[model samples]
Target: MPRENLPEGFEFVASLPDPDGRVNMTDEIEDFYGKLDIDPVDPANISVGIYQWADPGLAYDAKITIIRLSDEEKADNAISNFKSQYDEMVARGLPIFSNATVNGHPSLQIKDVRGDNSIRYLFLWRAGSLVTLVEGNQDRNQSLELAEAAPL
Candidate 1:
């Protein structure tokens, strides 16, 4: 299967940039896998990438992450695990989920209030063996839009 790449206008950012400066990108799989508490499948064959684009023109910073598992069952289980974990948070009013669809795949549109003024939007979906997430610093709708663009 082909790996998913970032959409137009987005570039890979090494880390959260300091004052909006470019940083060198590095191999991401090991780090990402290490951060995961649950082993969805063997981590070696997973394909993943993180991309960011700061748009002064649109006035929003966008980040998208694509993770492809080995098979459909693994991806489905991962999505279900994610939903269960986030559902607890939703119960606390920290983050909430809205039923959405991305490229014909069921999606969870997540919203969280950071403070009185700051809000975060995250959209996640599973299509076959691939799972995609789009997050924006400010734009709620943009996250869903990016999720729809994912190659399912």
Candidate 2:
């Protein structure tokens, strides 16, 4: 996570507990994949950082998750799994962009519209042995900006 590069008005929030400083997802593989609706991919470790906007008028929060795999191949597989899931959603007529790039890296962007008319964006991409997911209750531009600024 790049605290300094966060968009203006965003403030840091507590990170998900990781007493060991490295959490192995395999321990909770079912719950993890269940939440994301994707097949599980073994990752060496994972970390999460949460952020909120200072402006109360903005209903936006961001969760940046970084997953480190044993090698680049595993990282690629993880990203592919996510893309495949998003592709299924797209087939069902959801507003998802499967062919986007963040910082010149291939990325997937999913636009979710809430009943309250607020939108959330999810961006996923991979760099070397690391896979990064940037999800937020913000617009597409803001999501991509955060993803680009991330220090993956």
Candidate 3:
């Protein structure tokens, strides 16, 4: 469908940039993977529905701001009115879960980020704002990049 064909709430936004442009983050990852003798599919292909620019529709029952939270900030906020994303991960029996830390992008308030043992995919989620990205296998690298790329 044409760009204009999409409904107001359904704007088109590819996870990777268009082929005509050299801006898709996925392309960069592909290039890096090629050199490593790996394929993009090798990584867990985690993804959230809406792209960065597209309209963030009614993802959650109510709209919430995508607070660019840091690891430290998340913890600080956790003291009050914070949800325990890790608790869910633990319940799901995630074997390869990487608990969010304030190591890098210190202002990223990622609600939930973990790997699903059953599907062998990594899931990075931000609830209240409703942004979920799932990467399977080696695709988890994408989540890492996205988290790092966030304006934390």
Candidate 4:
């Protein structure tokens, strides 16, 4: 399925394949995802899309995590939780925090307070019954543009 709303000249991948042309998810990726304090909506099925340039490059990579909640109420709760999580992070001295809109959906954008530019951008928003999270190492403007193009 064509999942995320990626901009022109971009596509989605199931996962980044290793040299063996296989996706090692459960053992490798899941653990790291778990470590991240910000998690996708819980107890809901998820569809993941790794966004990349059609021309391919390390610089043009991002991820979209779509959490399909079972009900509208669940989606609302998830959004609330997500906001609280980010609020807590800000309270803990996380510097960059901005609220914006992406294609009509309310979006929250955050960056590292420590001035580390490793993670260029992170965007979270709730659209209908889906809670979407976007992460990228690309430029902030590019990341926001990708989020704006999201199907949400």
Candidate 5:
């Protein structure tokens, strides 16, 4: 992820470590796919960037992960699968699933309530051969703002 394009008041924190030398998907990846009930597609490359708001009053953090597939076709397929799965979730009475256009790319905005009652916002979209997932501990609008500011 490019640091310069981050939203105003957001600062790059660190680059999270990738799963080490595994051909199969990691537990984290499996859990993410499990939530959507979709098979995980192994990415050719994965990049994770962590960011935090500079304002002391804001208690939100964003994690942006870009997964580059072997080709655009796979990227497209992955994004489509995510959209379909999210649609199913909405049909099952899940709250806060919507389609949006962020930075000119079609994105799915999801708000998930954890077991602890904490809220998480996710923005999923595809750009060329890259599939981006942005997760934040914030409101829907703030999550979209971060996704829009992201340099895909």
Candidate 6:
């Protein structure tokens, strides 16, 4: 199905691809979904995705993860840490995006901290629980927005 056909919760995120070439949806998701591989030179190629239900509580725990490293070693370490941190957090039944790659692009996780947590929209890729985001944020809308903005 075309991207426009996808529902509001679904995100269309992908490009023509680069040196490695374009990636087919089913294959891409199926390929790295359970087992993500990391690339050094093109850290952009490593990313993570997250999908949350339309619930008030869920809005505060939806996010995506991207990793850009100079070498596979770094990516491996990141993957390891990400897994450990992700597992530790999700074990609590909190919403999260543990494994995903944004259109084969690389990115870091970032987080925000404040005194209050009420009436807040925080997509804690690793909120308060354990995994501290290294390059994402509390702006939970960005992920779905970016994905929604992508061209088919």
What is candidate 3's lDDT per residue for 1-152, written digit by digit as tens?
A: 12333222334345333345555444333211221222222122222233222335522111111222234334234222232434465677754344553224223333334244323223344443222333222233433443333322
Off by over 4 Å in 6: 1-70, 98-134, 143-152
lDDT tens digits, residues 1-152, model 6?
Answer: 12444435543343323347454423422322334443322434434444443554544333333334445554454445444545644677655443433344332332233346432232222212122122222444554344333321
Candidate with the larger lDDT of 2 and 3: 2
Candidate 2, 1-152: lDDT as tens digits: 67776776566675654666465555422223422333444444666677886465466568788877667776666666556655666788876675678888877776765668677888877788777888765567767777777766
RMSD of each: 6.8, 4.4, 16.9, 5.8, 4.6, 12.9
The pairs that clash in candidate 2 are none
The lDDT per prediction is 0.56, 0.66, 0.32, 0.61, 0.68, 0.37
Task: List the candidates' TM-scores in order.
Answer: 0.58, 0.70, 0.29, 0.60, 0.67, 0.28
Q: After superposition, how far is residue 75 of candidate 5 from its true place, in Å?
A: 1.9
Which model, 4 or 6, shows the larger TM-score?
Answer: 4
Residue 102, model 1: lDDT of 75
Q: What is the lDDT of residue 56 in candidate 3?
A: 56
Measure candidate 5: CA RMSD.
4.6
**Candidate 6: lDDT of 30?**
30
Give me the candidate number with maximum TM-score.
2
> Where does candidate 4 stray beyond 4 Å?
1-11, 15-44, 53-61, 80-89, 112-117
Q: Which stretches of candidate 2 lie over 4 Å from their true place?
A: 18-44, 54-60, 84-88, 114-117
Write the residue-wise lDDT of candidate 4 on 1-113 in tens digits.
Answer: 24455565567765433345354433222412422243443422555567775467545556766676666666666656555545666777767678878877678886733
> Candidate 3 lDDT (Cα, whole model)?
0.32
